[model samples]
Target: MNNTETPSFEEWVHYCFTQGYSDFHTEPDADHYEAHEQRRQRFVDIDPKALSEHIIRLFSNPAFLADEYTDQQIADAVWFIFGLATTYFLHLRSEVVPRNVQIRCIESVATLYTDLFDRLCDKHDVDPNKSSSKDTPLEDAVYMIWDMDCIEGAVMFPKHWPHLVDPGFRVLETILEKCRTVTCKESALHALGHIHMYHPERVEKIIDKFLASPDQPGVLREYALDAREGAVQ
Candidate 1:
């Protein structure tokens, strides 16, 4: 594995589908974790910005806009980016990466998530106006929820990054109000609960409105209650 090499689109897909998948499953033990960290560090050790830019470039390629790529190819690409985004979060949490680099990485992950969400919606012909349509895949919603979870985790760190807080709230709130999947909604609620720990007053009204809605799902209602409890504690 040439750490300095920039993989072509097909090469990236193959690498992610093979080596990257195995890399993601490395255990948390000291030896395995260090090895995993070394692999990730290769991408970021010199230019922390390069890895994220490469991921974004792969995602924005013209092939995705055409019908040439199979659905499996697109899904694999997303999984690859998701795995990298998870690594980015680990880097941020460990505080090993420079603060400026960490911020750019955060924005990059958010951009990737938003781009993926819009692309998936366009592919599926999801109409924002029609809330009742079940045409959207649950996996698509899960992707967006995972993105929010990433942002939520970042905000929970002891050192606050003012730039991400509002955007995180907006994304979570959008998922809470508009997403049809119960699992996604529940994930959003839980992320909100974590966010509420830092900014209780900011989230109080939103949780109250969720609790007030009779049409809300039971799981969501339960999450809202838990968030409210967490806020007061």
Candidate 2:
């Protein structure tokens, strides 16, 4: 495509996957890689909000959630969403895209990743603590969930959308109750702490329960204590 031509949704997805923006492997030389980068920059420069909207639409497509793409491709796409939205929030501060649109985009991506992670866990019986063979699908999905939780805590928390925050709280609660991996549990706790920042009364009840329950992990208890301390300070 010429520089003057804007990439269609399909073309953009293909380009993102091929250019190492998505997790799929591509080994282009310096010139080819630079060309792809320039194209992507142009896409952003021309209309970053339009590009962002297209990405959200592409992700919302039912085919995306189906088995149409390889697991790696889906993971890559989810990670790409996180990278793009976070960078946009930091650099442009939602000037191009309306803040609400940016917030929804990030929320949708997080929800999608959470769904994908849950499916992977059920299908593979993922044990987060155990070492898996390199590049395994289960491993990738677990890592993706952890990364999503990190972003949710660090970025999404401040957006303070009640709809998203409520659902996110439920998801994190499920992770704490069902997930056995230390990393996943810790990530969930961190996310819960962030959510607590805005909805302190609601989150405080959950934290209190966790602290009082003998069945809960000690690490989780410590996290709850820390979150409470942070809240007061």
Candidate 3:
């Protein structure tokens, strides 16, 4: 209940399962789901609102996590938190969650995410940029898309949508649209996503439109589509 008193991992999971399965979610990784299932069931049938309030209170505390949680644990928890919050209050419920609330939520998870990343980087004894691994549950579902207003859900490419990662074009577009930092957006757009959805045409179009851009942002030419070879220019 208090910030200094963290919950056990088992407690956090029980809290969620008691609330009921996430209303708007893809299945979590098998291992992650299995781990949570080991905890007490949170919701077979219960008041969604009360459960949501309980969830909010639980995670709001800095001490909400189990000491042994890894990046995966933090990532999963973040997704569940957002999913529960949006389903019960934001999105179809209300469009706006104040900035202060949003900032606090993000800051709460920052340490964990950063720690996870640090651990991985350390294990490999390499810089994150040098690390070959390209994906994390946090990047796609948590950090990249988390915004104060919940204006858009997680902005990173879906694993199923490998094309979205193409040349970092659409990925950048996604970031700029859903993400907050300009530097990070640019980095993601130009470098990070080089595998699939790389559309240069869309980039041209976006650049042209934004040359005199007003505000809301614009999408480029071959973006979201294949613009390659002769099609690129």
lDDT of 3 by residue, 178-230 (tens): 43332233323333223223344555465444334344222322222222222
Per-residue alpha-carbon lDDT of model 1 for 69-155, expressed as tens digits? 444544444444444534544445344555555555554543433444333433444333333112433344333444433445666
Candidate 3 has what TM-score?
Answer: 0.33
Error of 3 at 173 (Å): 20
lDDT of 1 at 105: 54
Error of 2 at 8 (Å): 2.4
Superposed by TM-score, candidate 1 places the C-alpha of residue 221 at a distance from the truth, in angstroms, of 1.4
- Kindly provide the TM-score of model 2 when superposed on the true structure, using C-alpha atoms: 0.57
Alpha-carbon deviation at 83 in model 3, angstroms:
4.4
Candidate 2 local lDDT, 42-61, one digit each (tens) = 54444667666765676454
- In the predicted model 2, the residue pairs found to clash are none
The superposed Cα distance between candidate 1 and the true structure at residue 220, in angstroms, equals 1.6
Task: Judge candidate 3 at residue 180 and give its lDDT.
Answer: 35
